[model samples]
Structures are given as C-alpha cells and as structure tokens.
Target: MLNAKWKKMLVGSTVGAMLVVGAAGAAFAADAASPAKSEKHAAKHQAKLEQKAAAQGLTVQQLLDRQAARKAALEEKAKAAGLTMEQYKAQRQAEHQAKLEQAAAAKGLTVEQLKAQHKERHDKVVEQAKAAGLTVQQWKDRKKAEHEAKLEAKAQKKGITVEQLKAQLAAKKAAK
Candidate 1:
C-alpha cells in the first residue's frame, strides 16, 4: 500500500488530470456546436484565461506556457512509471474511485449515495447562483474575488503585499 504522502500526491495529480481533461472536453463540445457558439465560447475562455493570468501577475502567453509545461511534466511522469498516458490516467482514476468507495463506506453510505449527495449539493449551489442572477462560473468568480479582497485587507494589516503574504503562506504550508 502507498504511504499517506504518496496517496496525497497521487490524489493531487489525479485531480489535476481531471481538470485538464474536463477543460479539453468542454472545448471539444463547444467546437461541436455552431460556429458562432464556438467563437463565443472561445472568447469567453480567453477572457477567463486573461483574468487568471492577471491575477497571477502573468501574461496570457506565460500562463499558457506554464499549463503546457505542467502537462508535459505529467506525461514524462507517466512515461517514467512504465505506462502510457491513457493507462496512467486509468490507474489514477481507479485509485481515486477506490478512495471514494472507502470514504463512502466509512460514512455508512454506498458510492452511489455519496455521489447523489454531492450532486444535490452542487445543484443547490447552482440554484443559489441562478437566484443571484449569475451563472455558476460568475458566482465562483465573485466568491474568489471576495476571498482575495479579504486576503488583501489582512496583508495590509500585516504591512505586506498580497504576493508577499501568499509566498509566506505557501512557505509555511511547504514547511508543514
């Protein structure tokens, strides 16, 4: 069995893989729609990328480069593990599913029941966002902005820049 640290690393990598796959799926779906819709989706995605890059004090190209680099690194890791990319992804996914099953059993619920509960919570959040006249993405963006504002205020109180505060927090986390 893997140790706790290795398990955590695997889980984090699995989540990263999921996000990359999800984004690609979304882009593919958008392209499958009408040309106008595809253009709109592309514009929206670009805007999001710009926003994220700005938040990280990076240009859009720099952000894209980083994402490409991360993907290449993951691919290299899969190669080193004697697995193709697809095989590595499948293995990681199976591990993640097993962990979910264990968690559900510990909670006295089956995996299906746990999934239903999660879906219900997600639906509720979507409904809440709708009631606020915002799309789910918009709602999430608002919440993120609010969180950053609070962090900025706290950093100001400590007489540090937000970047400095974030670096300090990251260093502390790494030390742990």
Candidate 2:
C-alpha cells in the first residue's frame, strides 16, 4: 500500500503533467495559418516583385498589359479549336465555381442560398471585368455552359441522372 504522502505527490504530479500536455495541445491547435496573414505575405512579395519590375524600367501595369496581350495571342491560338477568349475565361471560371458550389451544396447550402449570398461578390467581379473591358453577356454564356458541363460530369461520375442529383441536392438543402 502507498503511504498518504506518496499518494498525494503522485496525484499532484499527474495533474501537473496533464496540464502541460493540455497546454501543448492548445498551442498546436492555435498554430494554423490565417488567410489575412497569407494575404499580407503575398502583398509584401508583390511589392518586391514590383521593385524588380521597376529595376527593369517596367511598371506593374505594363507587365499586366504584356500578359493580357499574351493571353489574347493564346486566345487566337485557341480559336483554331473553335473557342473564343471570352468563352475560355468564362468556361474556366464557371467550372471552378461549379465545384465550389458542389462542395458547398454537399455541406447543406441551397443553390438559391449560395447564389444569393455570392451574388454581391459575383456582381463586384463582373463590375471589375466591365471596367477592364470584358463583355458581361459573353462571360455569362461561357460560364453557364461550363457549369452545366461540370454538373453533367458529376452526375456521370455518381451514376445518377443530372435531374436526380439536382433533386437530391435540393432535398438535402431543404432538410437542413
């Protein structure tokens, strides 16, 4: 049998060890990176990039213009395959947005709910694109087709009809 003093000491030491382990676990949990910090890191890196560009006697806007020209040239290359630049941009955006919506819907957000919440962000991006001279209708058409294609692919992969998946998604959202 343990003596009273030894029993008390053992209990105290066990509690102290647990406290240390708990504190260490909390520290590890809090070690995740924040998006804002990452954004700041990127902004700082971009500033350094601009400094390099300036050393080459080029402004950031000039670099962007060059990139835009390259993109236009690529679009022309893609035209041989019957795709326009606007179509390509919209298709890419829509496919990505579709996947995001799929995941969000899987998490119980209704299509209407997701669209309503994201409409402002979408409008702001559209406004920015208009400011940058991209036509809204062209972008919308391409994006719609791409998103439809994504939904079709998802349906095919799951061995379900597109309408059935849509209904299931709707039902899931409604239950939530």
Candidate 3:
C-alpha cells in the first residue's frame, strides 16, 4: 500500500509538470510569432508617417503641430483670399468639381454618372470576392501582387527600380 501511494503521487506530479511545460512552450512559440508580425507592422506604419512628414516638408512633430494650427489659420487664409470661410470652401469645391468634370468628360461620362458606375463596380467586386471565399485582405494582396508585377516589368524594361526611374527623371528635369 505504501509503495502504491508513492508511485501514484510521483505520476501525478510528473503529469502536472508536463502540462505546465507544454503550456509554457506553446506560449513561448506564440510570443515568438507575434513580435515578428508586430515589428513588421510597426516598421510599415513608421515609414508611412515619415512619408507624410516629408511630403509636408516637416518633421513628424512639426507636421502634427501644423495640423493642430490649421484650424486657427483657415479663417485667416480665407480672409486674406478675399472670401469668407464658407465662400472659400465652396470655391474650392467648385474647382474640384470642374477638374472631375473635365476628367469624366475625357472618359465620356458626367461626373455624377461616373461616380455611380464606380460605386456599382466596387460593390460587384466586393460581392464576388465574398462569393469566392476571399477576405478583403486577400483581395488586396492579389491586387498588390498584380501591381508589383507590373512595376517589376516596367523596371525591367527601364533597367531600374522605380526609385531609380524617379531619380533619372529628376536629373533630366534639373538638366533642362
């Protein structure tokens, strides 16, 4: 009876330790996978923010400060332009509409009609993807692959990456 009880206790303790070790291994593997994913995500987000800052010719903090200051400056800019804020907004919208109208006319459609067509096409694509068991990200990945292929083909033709092509163009413009 004493030997049986000792054997039982040993078995129970071994099983418990194995369970804890198994759980720890699984948790470690999960943690390992996520840091790589999160690091990639963080890198992409940082690149995007940097691009936005560069486009504005400002540092990231300055870009944020500029956006914060824009609210107070909007009225001043509009006033300087000899229009009230509402008038300025309407004028800007009219200019945008005119550009859109010109673009739509080139494609043989009115702007409103063209937008409806675009909405219908977008909806159809979404519905078809759902029917085909594709998530939005899957569709986006396919589109990205297609775009990258085109870019690669173009780069091959030009014998350069897109960045190299842009640099060549800039050099040409500067020479001119």
Tell me how candidate 3 scores on lDDT: 0.83
Deviation from native of the Cα of residue 54 in model 3, angstroms: 27
lDDT of 1 by residue, 1-176 (tens): 99999999999999999999999999998778879887889999999999888655578999999999989998998999999999998998999999999999989999999999999988997888879877676778888999999999999999999999999999999998
Q: Return the number of clashes found in candidate 2.
A: 0
Residue 153 error, candidate 3, Å? 6.6
TM-score of 2: 0.30
lDDT of 3 by residue, 12-69 (tens): 9999999999999999999999999999999998898887786445688887787778
Clash pairs of candidate 2? none
> TM-scores of all models?
0.41, 0.30, 0.36
Clash counts for the predictions, in order? 0, 0, 0
Q: Which candidate is the best by TM-score?
A: 1
Report, for every candidate in turn, its global Cα lDDT versus the true structure: 0.91, 0.80, 0.83
Q: Model 2 misses residue 168 by how many Å?
A: 1.0
Model 1 lDDT-worst window of ten: 50-59
Model 1 lDDT, residue 123, Cα: 95
Return the TM-score for candidate 3, rounded to 2 decimals. 0.36
- Candidate 3 residue spans exceeding 4 A from truth: 1-77, 121-158, 163-176
Error of 3 at 32 (Å): 58
Deviation (Å) of 100 in candidate 3: 2.5
